[model samples]
Target: MVKQWWAALIAASSVLAGGEWQNCFNGKNLNGWTVKVTGFETGQNPGNLFRVENGLLTVSYSDFPNNSFKDEFGHIFINRPFTNYHFKCEYRFLGDQFPGGPKWAHTNSGVMLSGQAPETMEKEQKFPTSLEFQFLAQNESGTRTTGSICTPGTYVDVNGKTIKQHVIKSRGTALPAGEWVQAEAIFKNGKVSHIINGKTVIEYSNPKFDDGTPLTYGWISLQAESHPIQFRNIQIKELD
Candidate 1:
């Protein structure tokens, strides 16, 4: 179960804690990012699903036919991996769901944590082995929590107990639609915490692949699961 536990831990405390913040999203282009769409080879952008517009790294669906998404999930990942760091970003749901995604993905998009390399994933793989720090937007109708955790081909532990199930809810309330919500993740001391706005929403430790390989380091990626979302201010700080 321990692929050596990544050999270390990474975390994001307060950005105010301040090391040096690297702008993962330069706000101009996807220069250092890699695209991986389901059923497509790595580095392929089948439908222009990911792009930069108006200085924001965006996930758009204008190319898909009306009511014809066909479950074409995708991700754009940083070119390299990281360990013992803090990650932060701003996101807002836009447009409508692509009509083919699961109901739970209606207002969902996320930044993947401790994810497998983009190049290693199978062409038809829906998602990589990673912990998802999901951002759920509020529809003003019912209860939903932002900054929740979802394991896709991965798993984590909480409170010193083994939690193999997927979809762990967070304490943070659902943020309003069309508004930018601040989301962050801190991987430190062998534990990880999800922060929404200014509060810690969910926390866990011991991330591992479904096959039980320890995830000590991984690439940071943004999800495009049939929903249009905007991600900006993507930054990271490696802890000393």
Candidate 2:
């Protein structure tokens, strides 16, 4: 009986892990994504803000003139829009936050899901209307969760009620600065799951725009929000 039970469990797990995953970051260049920044034109990475180095897709600000951030909130968006899929990536904070960045942006970044295309954003748009899988590492003095959700120009249903708040905390794992963390998002239909280090931290259903329109599909984006961060092994598998 134990042998039969183990076989069944493996079969069920395979169903949840359906379809083959393809690499979203090519590791050599930003070939399959578009870069958008608040001040610069779309696709213009003035400071090499987004680049691949040492086999990792890095969001670096070292080239910024005068070493100033300039409030150039940026997003490197996946080339295509996805509807039902499982996306995962590993990220780690590398160094200090850029000067002149938001005070709250210390060791902060995120992955944007259900987001509008880069082409559709206004020239000065800071963030797209989407659900953000907010990533944060503990500062030198305090603790912060790593897999929370932030809604910008959107809303999600949690606990069977619609929430319009901009930020919602998740019971995600907490880690010290400079430690690599794994974050995953599973989106099927209108439901979404945020996971950190293999634990499901937050779950939301029926994600839609604040204007009452349902958001069933959209592009994925990686944030470059005034922090030096590195992401690698970004892959996505389609879900039926």
Candidate 3:
């Protein structure tokens, strides 16, 4: 069933308005998306955790009770499954990490691809089954890179070898927290590539579930990993 859906979507290969690339985000509101967050029922955004202002989509925490970050991880998902395309966006960190958020979560967020639909996720599920293009800021220390891959409930083969570890580092350089960084992922069949700022940093193939089930197509989601982040210029280019 899933495989059939993947094939149908991939075969469509629709071009975006006026060109080969389509702007997934309309830059005004969350129109073609769904929200799922922990500590709240699915689709219940207690705070304006996901909002757009001045044409920038922001994940904020100003409205949570006590204005504290309470592990309320969230995802804003594009409303469909996709395959064989290049997804790209620009993002930057903003403000300090809300109190009680994990130290590692400061300035950390991701774009999750090949993920299950928001309706299928458990109410308290921490993450979806997908490949995460983990975006990290320099945090002023200047050692963390932005284009790493974190597999949650999935795995991928890289360099002809299966990596048992969860997070795979990319070769991209890290950028400062305040700067908008360009992050992208290209997918064809089961092969995936992560690019940061126009540089190809990671490449892997044969993405599959932990139980060895193949993962060919799924939803695209922007993560709210307990931080304030902003994303802009979200677009995709369907490939042949």
Candidate 4:
């Protein structure tokens, strides 16, 4: 059933918005983005954690003093928010995990969806109130799958049941590190879906805040958890 949805969506991937896809990252710089890392004010990029390198928007830890990441979870958000759209990107995990980060964050990063504005987050807020389209790669411990959904401060109904758990694994492909994988999300008309490498892994609907308000739209951001990762070819297309 999910495969059927994937086939339909990817078929429409090329020609959405009149055969035009909006390039989110200009590849030269982070001009249309905002940085919000915990323990730092908005726009203050500590340790040069997020930067443009080799024409890719990268997350690295090469500049941290004393090899400490300082647990400053970070995110770079597009300045403009979206309501209904298709977002796609290619991501890959890189070298070692920085010190001072939790084990769970190793090779772990995510794309924040329906998120609050960068400026609205607290100085020490761990994560924004949003739905996270999670990404994971293999580590020494074991193999992990990508495309799982994590709800930081929201809820959704999956398979006709309300799911309140924090993170739910998807029936996604398990690939190793160092390989670039395609990740995507579709949030249209109060329905949500996650796709990985052209496979539809999870689907849900009725996203609502803890306060019972329907969450139809918000900002989108890429995560900078405690790992070395790079993102490229980030693009989005609005659905009507």
Candidate 5:
């Protein structure tokens, strides 16, 4: 009876350990990711652009010097490629400004999906040729809202209606600045979904770019576009 109980306990532990919420970021190093761009470089060991703290993977921009901006476009992309999966993360607006930064940088950041080769992007290119799950904060113009889709080279449709504009129509009420929000993207069977705080903010299908080409799979990346943003709880589960 004692041996049987021990075996049962081990089986249960293994099942729990193999469940969802697997840590993508190693937390101690950039082992599973690749960085591409000029003017910017990874930070100190174990605690850099992507760090693990208190069981959370934090993408921080605080360690770099204030004058670090020298047109240094940087991206930390997942080394592994994914085709159909559900990705989710928790993000917070740092509200910190950099010297000589763009005026709207405070409300700017995004997650690039179906992304291009990081090395293929030209040195002067500002963004990747992929679909962007744009994360925005409340701004003076009121155009920056969370859960909006921005197609760099792709477009989405709603209810069979093609979206002519680059930006999608906002789904829920705008979230105030300086708060953490949960964001999720479901990519399966040539469809995608953008969800915010448990609410389906945007749902569209048949994502393709301006050239009328379909995106089957690509790397996932996070942007540090002249603004301070932090992301945690980054995880992805593969789909059949």
Candidate 6:
């Protein structure tokens, strides 16, 4: 009887440990999502930048100069909001660039958290006031890596080191510019752990970039910058 009890306890613990993660995007359609954006006129506008086909969430910019973000600026925020969770997604660079935009907009994409409502943004606003997990592809020399964090209204500490800067560039292996990379972010309390390709590139705590005004929770958003990017396998698991 004692042995059976112990076995049962272990099994239960294992199941609980594995049940913390949940899939946010169904890899099929934009069923559980809402979009807020100003735009041009087309089937591939900013509100429609994210699309699902063959179980992949593809972020394309081929119609940029034609349909999306041509004269309007906006963000497409996720319909749901989360506080403490583990968010994971797979992304890839499509190696397509635009003729005109900011210098960094060539291969720029990001996951915005703790962000404001998309409809509430200013007409000419550049970016939302939130914590941004910056995604960069190889510019010229392939120097950039994954797992970098850009704090718009937040900061974080790691191992007693409180970062006061805006960008915490991760020191991980450089992902190939045109390949798929697995990105993971562990959020709990006010801390974050940035993982890329199954490797932990950066860990931060107590995030607050707004001059000590810490943000505990907000919405999640994906970037539709003037570049071609693709994402899939988006899922999250709530934490206790």
Off by over 4 Å in 1: 1-19, 65-67
Report the alpha-carbon TM-score of model 6 versus the true structure.
0.79
Give model 1's TM-score versus the native structure.
Answer: 0.89
Question: Looking at model 5, which ten-residue stretch has the lowest summed lDDT?
Answer: 1-10
lDDT of 3 by residue, 3-71 (tens): 334444454325222328888899888998899998677677767889997899999888766567667
Deviation from native of the Cα of residue 151 in model 2, angstroms: 0.5
Across residues 1-240, which tens digit of lDDT does each residue of candidate 4 receive? 111122333443444342358899999999999999999899988878899999999998788554676668999998767778899999999888888889889889989997777877889987877899999997565657789999987889999899999998888865787899999999999898899999999999998776666776677899998889999999998875
Off by over 4 Å in 2: 1-18
Per-residue lDDT for 188 in model 4?
Answer: 91
Q: Sort every candidate by lDDT, greatest first.
A: 2, 3, 4, 1, 5, 6
- Each candidate structure's TM-score, on Cα atoms with residue i matched to residue i, is 0.89, 0.90, 0.91, 0.90, 0.78, 0.79
lDDT of 1 by residue, 27-126 (tens): 8878999999988899998667898889998898887544576668899998777777899999999898876678877878899987877887889898
**Candidate 5, which segments miss by more than 4 Å at Cα?**
1-21, 38-71, 140-143
- Residue pairs in candidate 5 whose N, alpha carbon or C atoms collide under 3 angstroms: 153-209, 154-209
Question: How many pairs of residues in model 4 come into backbone collision?
Answer: 0
Which candidate achieves the best TM-score against the true structure?
A: 3
The predicted structure with the larger lDDT, 3 or 5, is 3
Please list all clashing residue pairs in model 2, or write none if there are none.
Answer: none
Task: Using TM-score as the measure, name the better of candidate 1 and candidate 5.
Answer: 1
- Score candidate 3 by lDDT: 0.85
